[model samples]
Target chain A: MSDKTTGNTTGTDNFPQENNESVKREMFKPLSRRSFMKAGALGALMIGGTATALLPLRNFKNDTSLENFFQQHYERLTPERMERILKRIEREIKERHGVDANVQDPKPIADVQFAYALNISRCIGCRRCVHACVEENNQSRNPEIQYIRVLEMPAGTFDVEKSDHYYSHETVPAEGKYYMPVQCQQCENPSCVKACPVSATWKDKDGIVVIDYDWCIGCRYCEAACPYWARRFNFAEPNIPKEQINPDMAYLGNRIRKKGTMEKCTFCLGRTRKGLLPKCAEACPAGARQFGNLLDPESVIRHILREKRVYVLKEEMGTRPKFYYWFDT
Target chain B: MKNNYKSVQNEAVPEFIRNYGLFLFQAIRLSFRGSTAFYAWMIFLSLLSFFGLRAYCNQFVEGLITTGMTDQVSWGIYIANFTFLVGMAAAAVMLVIPAYLYKDEEMHTIVIFGELFAVAVMVMCILFVTVDLGRPGRFWHLIPGIGRFNIPVSMLSWDVVALLGYLAINAHVCGYLLYMKYLGKKPNKLLYMPFVFLSIAWAISIHTVTAFLYVGLAGRPFWNSAIVAPRFIGSAFTAGPALMIIAFQIIRMTTGYHIGDRPFRLLRQIMTISLLTTLFLLGCEVFKEFYSQSLHNSSARYLFFGLHGHYALVPWIWTAITFEIAAIIILLSGYSRKPGSFVWLNMACILATVGIWIEKGPGLIIPGFLPTPLGEIVEYIPTYNETMVCVGIWAIGALIFSWMLRLAIPILSGIFRKKNE
Candidate 1:
């Protein structure tokens, strides 16, 4: 590409030479030892100037706090270290939100794989479980981050695309509508866990997928990778009134999330691991929600799995969700 | 003389390092010296870049709520621009392949510029990715050892490896060649040839891995097609070369550099085929989505035709399609080759460049999230702050390219050779 253009420019009356000479007349000086030294000094000055201009960014350390910002990932934290971290989180929450927060790191019970089964036939589409979850999990109230989305589908159609996510009806189960509340499925093969580049989220021994809020880079790859739309990102600082603050928080569960991290339903492992029912399950007024240990052969979830014609959402996506929905036989 | 040569050989490491350092110093000095117009352009770009920094600072302090992205539409224009620039970076391989593999003499001389362009675009890609991160401060968590690096499983890790590897490769190749030129020495084939070939393969991997970043996700049906990788390659070659054509022309006109018409002709030919392939792949995708008509087709529907009256993207995509069609027709008709019809060539190149930016940027990204995974139709519009940030990133890219070209033009023209030489 060079030879021809150089030839053409030369042919066009030494225009290239004139341009070069003009540049030389203005800015191009013959390189000398002194000039080289001057350039080096100038380069150093420029570099120093840029570094000084960016010095204010150091204030960010004080904001996120150096300790909280670089805290160890959940799995790697030893019990003593975890206790210290929990105290730090409690202090930070109390300082930030002006509330006494009891932050706990609840471990999954061994040999217990928690599972949930919802009786779709009994669901009234009241959306009470959605609000109950927010109150229990300490989700942001201003932008209203809800883990559960009660999709109202029309009668006789299994098409999720046709369902209404923001449906507002006057009464219970308006006419021919049915409600299917979807949250994190706690998948055995969770796509969100795989999509995470930092390994900040993982499937626990109890089948619940949990996120290390401190460790997440907030790239939102997991949000896009999830087929169930189970993942949520804190786009803004999470807002909760001091009174509404769920002081009983778990480290990998409903602990108050900072801005720019991924959060989702941990199947209320904060409660479930302690043999307490999930907030959503406990709040379902219709007695439609069921939660139990799937490993226990005599458990309701195991019986439901064996007998009920239960359906898993987006089963074709190959995410083996433990959350089952079955209509009454 | 023989004894002096022996002494120099003994001190090869320090001698070589000093010479390389001198070469870098000289290159930096040259970048500072340019005409009034060049200074004006650089200043303009600097202002834009400073504005971008200011906006980013605000975003940093206020959180992503300053941007339009929400939980529903998580990945927005930053990701869109990242995707497009990745293609631009990969496009440098088009020049590399012709220069090395085919031994096109015309391409060989100018391939350095292409690699330089790749370096600039790759920098932009990195910055875009960084700015998009919710916790940019926690980026260290992605480091291999200190942080948990999810490799071999997450396609994102593959992307990180591919992108950084490609950046390092191109930077090394450019640095080696430029330094060789500055030293008045022949660049050893052993030193750079293997790297050049690796880069050619690595370029394709960067785009393939980027596409796989989206393709591997079964959640987004719009990107789950087998043809996405092929389409990414197809569009990248088209936009990358078209950009080179325009940039080469500007360089030739301004600096009186000898950028021959041969590379332009070669690139235009490449574009003709690649553009056609891009359209054909688009046709295939459209056919499968509309013809089969499954529940998964809602995203495609939302992209091509609005879903539930949310048609904000409809005009944008159609405009992109029109531009591509027009550019393809102009190229195919041979109007660009006719005397005094270089305007047609410029128009076609610009059309193709902007067209692919839309098709790949907003057209591809926004739609993928639309009728979002759980069938929610949430439209993502880039706010002024977001758009300003993008503009700022592009200006930064332009500034980097301009500085590198300023240094290169003098050296390539033999005006700025080694001082003693």
Candidate 2:
């Protein structure tokens, strides 16, 4: 290669002894020490750049920031830190989706634990609740995240094996079947909370299990832990359009979730914390959903528990879910 | 086997402790010294790894959507391979038990190869986990103090600790012994001896912990069983020693690092017992699922007979079972005594290794998720890119194992002999 280069420069090969010597010098010369170091440095920089380019840049930014390192668990975070994180989330949501979402940390009300009751007889299984929950929670549109799965079961038996969640029937609650909408059971002993290796998820004082998305390592332990299959994973970035983004968000609830974290039904914390029903319960056209403070004697859930023969899914597992199901008849 | 190198000023102090650069350069240089086939294998592994990395990069860019795993099957081939590799890594304990506890000399010398294999496989285990994570960058979330890892609550946390601890112990023992060999000195019995014992116990725990990661999950009835841990140990022992059997033969043929027939014969026995036990346990699981007629049997039923017309894993499970049966037959045959039956022994080892890989990986994990929590059975098939990453990690493991053997074999055989000798 050096001989060809020298010939090209001199316009003749072996035309002169000096040219041959120059060619030999060029060909036989060892790489200079400084040049070697320069090449090594360039190589290191390129490799580093390529590696850095592979990761989600936004995740890196949030995960490595000083505040992220010092961030506390949802239960441990002080009011000031909570407010700061809330504001940060609001700003991030605005930047990512062009929406002025109200990201707040809603505290569990004192002496007010929550419970839900679903009237199986009245549900038409229209699947309106599934879409409403996903939309209100700012779930991933591409992955089609839906927290609520309405299973159509044969009326005579509650055999889960015979039930199907993805049955595409053309009518309301197809004949000889009952619609059973299953979401986060919010068990008194939630397996998901127990399974989280990072303590990123936990049951709040309000009887709703919540996850700290920022703190989640996205190991999907919680997803694997859920008995109801109620959990959803963000396989990619939550691609909600600007117009579709719900401005009302909560830190542990219906906030714009990020890629890779686990999100599940929070019983619509943004609304529920404000004494309103969850979006799914409100969206139910059959009025089959029931929500109230379980501890309150006057609450309708307490009345149903007393009057009806309520059953919990997987009762043998000892999960003690706060969500109950009963026949309206 | 005698120490006869030039003495340093502080003969008590190690040469590596004094001048690290010389030891490192020499070790690295020795890794590159091998036969043409060895070099060819290395080049092939490197190229495979290169394509694997490129595929991984594409997956990173496009997200897990590049894979066929949906919510129904969140964990596909990667997690399955990770589980199998953990068992492979733990199989080093088989060597540790015979060499350290039983004080067998030939086993002692060859144990280093098993340990080297452990280090390589452990690295692959970690890589598989990293690639499987949706947010590998936020791995800091698992770091102590820096990030919150729920230690006692999550079985996964326990697995992480077990694997890292196993890696540390094996690395320390391997490094200490090899360095002592390079310097032509006796390894301090106290230095690596305690670690060898610790590693034996730690090896069992790594697989047990991994099994617990699946079994402790209340959602997957297929995994939630007392049989989970024992079955893991059973498959691991069958797979692990079977691997060492193959490695010993390869090392003998290529490097002339001959380990006698005793280790091979003993390993054959272990493999036979463990393989049969695994097959029996599989039978028990099948009967329990099919006979009892419980709702939980849905997963096991799916695994064996195909549930609801989605039998993607049907061929794989059957093939693995066939391999296991064939391995059992070969190990028990009259060829067991004949020295000329080296090929048969190697074949048995190969069958066991491949059989356990299929048995422990997709056959075990995917079914746990099938008839998913909501009674949905969405079949999972690994994509080309996902396959690329898996193959890449495997190639990296093979290369690391090759390099470790390259450096260790020469020292053990006295290729770097004393001047007087």
TM-scores, one per candidate: 0.93, 0.89
Q: Show model 2 residue runs off by greater than 4 Å.
A: A1-72, B1-16, B416-421
Please give the C-alpha DockQ score of model 2: 0.19
Question: What lDDT score belongs to each candidate, Candidate 1 first?
Answer: 0.86, 0.80
Write one digit per residue (lDDT tens) for candidate 1, span B247-281. Answer: 98898788777767788888999998999999999
RMSD in Å for all candidates:
4.3, 10.2
Question: What tier of docking accuracy does candidate 1 attain?
Answer: acceptable
Relative to the unseen true structure, what is the C-alpha lDDT of residue B4 in candidate 1, on a scale of 0 to 100?
21
Candidate 1 has a TM-score of 0.93
For residues B1-421, what per-residue lDDT tens digits would candidate 2 score against the true structure? 1121233325677745544445564565455445568767877787678767877877665667777777778888999999999999999888889878887765766788889999999999999998888767678778878678888878888988999999999999998887666666788999989998899889999999999999988779999988988899999999998888887888867764545677777788888899889989888878888899888888988988899888888888889999989988988897755664678877888898898899889989899998988788899999998998999899999989998887776556544212112
lDDT by residue for model 2 (A1-329), tens: 11112111111221234543453343224446865685576467546644653543333334235675457667678888888888887776677678888787778888888999998878899999899888888887876888888899887887777888778976777888888889989999999888888888898888889888877777787777788888888887678778888898888888877777788899998789889999998999998899999999999999999999799888877789999998868
Instruction: Kindly give the stretch of ten consecutive residues in candidate 2 chain B with the minimal lDDT sum.
Output: B1-10
